[model samples]
Target: MQARKTIIRLFTTFLQFDSDKAIGWVTDGRLRRNIVNSQVYSSEIENSENFWVTYWYKQWQDNPKSLAKEHLLAYLQETCYWVASKTVKNIYSPQYTVSDCFQMMIARTDKVLKGFKPEMGFGLKNYGSAIFSSELKELLRQEQEIDICTNWRLLRKLTQKRLTESLENIGMNSKIIERYILAWKCYQMLYTPTQRTGTRKLQKPTLQTWEAIAELYNNQRLKQLPTNTPECSPEIIEKWMVASAKAVRAYFYPSHISLNVPHGNSEASRELIDDLPGDEEKSPISQIVIQEEKLAREVQQDRIKSVLLTALEELDEESRKIIQLYYGAELSQQQIAKKLEMKQYNISRRLSKSREVLLYKLAAYCKESLHISLNPPVLDYISTLMKEWLKLKFNPPTSEMEN
Candidate 1:
């Protein structure tokens, strides 16, 4: 009760509203019910959450900076809080508190709202929670890379554009940036972690590895850079690599954006909103692809089931049991490990491996059978489709089981 009041108070202050008015507006029954009554079915009035969502969502679409949008986001703070609580428990990272995660989720309000569709048969909060979870998980995964990896691994993962930006951010000259990029490229090619090295904890390069990287950089420097440039020794290479890592780390640290600030001037805001999906006119190919995807979804559910079943059959007995226990029995990884007398980490890895198998099979089926191009969006679609199938297959609805 006290926590809710605190959030309400903060929301009021953040929006610069009178405390009494804020309370009244949030509690207003007529605004919640009457406005959406005509839009929703008669049956949905009893639970007016979706109605309120539809009400303010429409207003937000009409104007992103409107008070209606602010009110809508404020209303959904409880929903966002619920998600953040569960996320903190699951992720259990020392670096991120519940407040930190909640703020991050709030920062992504535009993205969450952009992905919601009333016609999709999901409530706004439900869809928003899923998006928030996925986005948060990806963010944490990136943070994990930064947290656990050595300088060499960090350098290896940095994209050319990122490395250039980091170097330029730190006031490095163009020529110096070019040299660092080439040196990092050579380092990436030579300093490979051993197979036993986990993805999360990449071992630092050995002296021999650094020497080899320096040798490679020396050999390639003249070809890539001016002949007058000095050849870099192992010590010089290590120093540059450390500097690059620090710069990349500083540049890529997460920064949360607040909702209170204006997005931009009207024209730029319009352009930003125009870039959202389904806002602008898509090309002919895009239209056909969208149509084909919709049609395929309607028809391909059963085909995907069969394809996934075949793929599951390919799994080893242990992997099969792990999937069954995790999905069918709906057990946590720790519980599954306890039951099977396996290590918890082993259980986690197997579960991931099982998903990878299913994902691969689903992608292949989409390409070979459905003839869908395996683009990122299409792959993501297939992955989601596969998960839905697995959930339904392993744990059918209670009504279906009874029937």
Candidate 2:
């Protein structure tokens, strides 16, 4: 009973420490090997009920400072990967590969682990798997929804493009083009063919649909004007729909007006006039400004590369390898884990830590050597730029690159 009390107390103490600092304590090479090499801990971990809870409690009791994050990370990696793989199969998109799923799982698991309660009498595997699966499903659902919306928008754009061309050919006014498009879309939504009957039905537009279309049009118009514009009324929208229907009917019927040299005298004519080629030569001042801006960007990129290279050199060999394998070699974390004989989650942690260290060192180098102090946002941008540069430099080119 005393041992049980001691174990509970130890578990509470482990929970008190910040996860990163606690993990860092066990991430030390010697400490990790010590924990892994322990015959008693190994035997208990494999055979015991509530393995992680019992193992962690034992570590805390034996040495309060000897918390092993590697064990926790290994369990997280295995469970997360399994859950991610299963989840990805359910997702229809080929783009959401096992690697992508695993990456997302690991990213979310970090935050989830911080909230883990070992004292709740559940093992980490069940708790962690539940969290992993929930997050993966949510992510996949969001991506699928986004894809559906994007495809719908693209189809709408194509329809609008063809409609716009037809309207312009008939010399329709530009100002009312969008209003006509919105009214037409509302009409289609209200009157599309019924799936079961496979027949087009004429349906009256609902007041709600008309109001929504007006609001959308008004919002779009408001963005273009410097001053506030009055919102369109439903009455005015109905009149516009009447006018659009008349114009569309006239468009289908052959008439002298339709053949009147395409009426090259309306707003559409002005648009065509604007699109006509002007002088090819740029003004000298504009040319010089463009050249100077390009040069400045090039110089900034070079400076960022130089600073990042210096920082990379300053990192320890292991951290450097993590960066190289990830950014430089483009290998996934699981692949790096196999190469290094470490847990996949450990590889993720190391890569993240290495990037943080590199950013810090880069900031320090800029302050001392370049006489410039970078804020967090700027440092983040520089780090992203450096990673992109490494990818471009190391990754094999696609067909576009070969061309």
Candidate 3:
């Protein structure tokens, strides 16, 4: 009977039975006898409110040899299916499977459980849930960030291809072309890959930055060259480095490049098209042009609102709660601080920072996914419109007011 009840509990865990059902079965006299007989389950079930702890303990004990090698793999698999389920839904890419999340959760949970003690007075389920959920959220956040970085890498490759083709068309010298490519590589490395938003904050690359890149490049070339070959002079290397730095600075800043002054050829214009937003080609003069333009702008405003709502989901839970209370509930910063037991200044600062982060993310999304730029003025308009939309969404008009 004890063995039969133990089998039933194992099946219940595998099938993911609801807590009440599992608890009912676990607290039954027969199941309690099985749990009492299982020495590993006795300690965990002593003060537990639910059956999950005993079930998890049983699973862990049943696979003691596997546990010795893999630690929490069996235990987490029995206990944390919900963690994998939730993580899978949040991951932006389809490439990651639920099994991948499960493996990651097991690894993270093993590390966390190493520090856990029975005397801590917290149930394993509660502690494990908190740790696993937090780690899973961070993992999902990184996956989203990686998706953004991957898109930026593709953008860089496409830009490099276009620049190469354009320079070749102009009949540029091979050495100069190499210098230009080297300069572009230096420029790319000056900023970290993850922060390469279209409207990223720009800083002028210093001479030291160029020198470091040049030294690294020279060392790599020295490694590949045969010992019999004469090394390039310091003077020649310095000259190449200077030229590469100049080319990179020009490519990124382009302060001297004039978009307003029309270049004579199609190739010049095509080069500009990829770097600058293309000007809309003129269509036949029509009487409804003004109305069409107005309608288009309205459609764009609607899209911005939709995108803002989607971006809100990316914010952390605390930030999301503040946004909901302040924007959705129409609470002031002071009122929100009071309700949340935080400083008024902190509340105000969080709201300001959250808005800025959201706008930056929104701009990046528009540039990457929609092939549109969200300039300062456009972002300002969208921010105002989003607030108004949120008000309508959350604080609907009363029936009496509607009448």
Candidate 4:
């Protein structure tokens, strides 16, 4: 079963649990009476009834009970309520998908029909209900958030401070070429995602901020920002250094990049559509074909990520630090080398060797798990194969598999 389908089935079962099965305590039932010594009292008694436990044990157990009755008393009432509440929530929550609805409906039909499908009607005819034909229309709607932004002035103040701090940190030592990337990191939070950028709530930044950042970068390129030996406020610089690092930190957080492959989607998608670097006048179908090919390429990249994480686990602290400081931390080769107190050349050599070893490990795992030979290890082909494997799992075969 597909994971989603299995989850739906389990959730549906929770929704439709019998009251008897869900209630964990005998006292939770409709009947409640005190069976006292020599007097079968039909009186409703609270759990505080005297020596009720000993009386129940004597009457109910065939022998000495396995569990101490005292041990269960504290939890029995609470457990029954919890179980019943959980069942109710699981069945009716909107979080339950159509697959859950299908399971519940089928189960209800089975019980009432007694070994006959609701569709078959169990040797009954003319039981058909009236059918209505209408145009497809959407009914569900709710109030939406208005497209007004908040805290505009406060946001601008933060952005100004952030830009200044970033400049102070990267002064003299920073590569001028990476100024665009620096500007992007500082204001990344400001820009809405592509899907939401069209929405009116997220205000676009004025050209002034971009122009200011560009002008500063140009001055730095012309040897005009701060000098290595300039008189400075060491305290202010330190604070800015921390702030700048934090801004960079946001870009490299694990949650940003570790998106799961969608249920009908996968992380194997590529940025191939960014440029569309081929014949521009091609048919739409050809472009789609190109996208499909791009989707296939990410499977291997995903595999590479898995292999790298495993390799990092097996390495010493120093090596693991280098791997993350290079990859997950998104530090450039020179930056990582400076952080680690190693030569840039050495960093390059280590990264190259790690890549070779890690790819070999992934190839071995592929062969072991799926019997895939992966001749010459074409990454794009591997990605395609992974997609096909996923499709095969959910798309049941029309014909029997050959033994």
Query: Rank by lDDT, descending?
Result: 1, 2, 3, 4
Q: Whose TM-score is higher: candidate 1's or candidate 4's?
A: 1
> Could you estimate the TM-score for every candidate?
0.47, 0.32, 0.31, 0.21
- Off by more than 4 A, model 2: 1-143, 147-281, 286-303, 366-373, 396-403
Better of 2 and 4 by lDDT: 2
Q: State the lDDT at 325 in candidate 4.
A: 66
- Candidate 4: tens digits of C-alpha lDDT, residues 1-403: 1111221121111211232222111221101111222123312221322223223232223222222222122212222223223333433345333322222222222122122111111110001000000000000010011112222222232344444444444453354314433444434444333434334344434555444544444444346433542322323333433445444333221111111112335564432112212221111123333334334434544554565467546766766566666645547889999998999998898876655555566566666754566675343333333322222333322231111
Specify the highest-lDDT model's number. Answer: 1
TM-score of 2: 0.32
Which lDDT value does model 2 have at 37? 49
Model 3 lDDT tens row, 1-403: 1111243343221211232111111222323333344434334333322233433333444443322212233233444555565456554456555545545565565544553332222345444654675676676664444334332243243356645654565567765666555545544665344454553333433456556656655555455544453434434544544444334333322222211224557654532212332122122123144334434544655666667777777778888889889856767888899999999999988888888777776667667755656677555544544454554456543322000
Higher-scoring candidate on TM-score, 1 or 2: 1
lDDT of each: 0.64, 0.50, 0.47, 0.33
In the range 253-288, model 1's lDDT, one tens digit per residue, is 556533333366675353222222222111112333
Window of ten residues with lowest summed lDDT in model 3: 19-28
Candidate 1 global CA lDDT score: 0.64
Residue 236, model 3, lDDT: 52
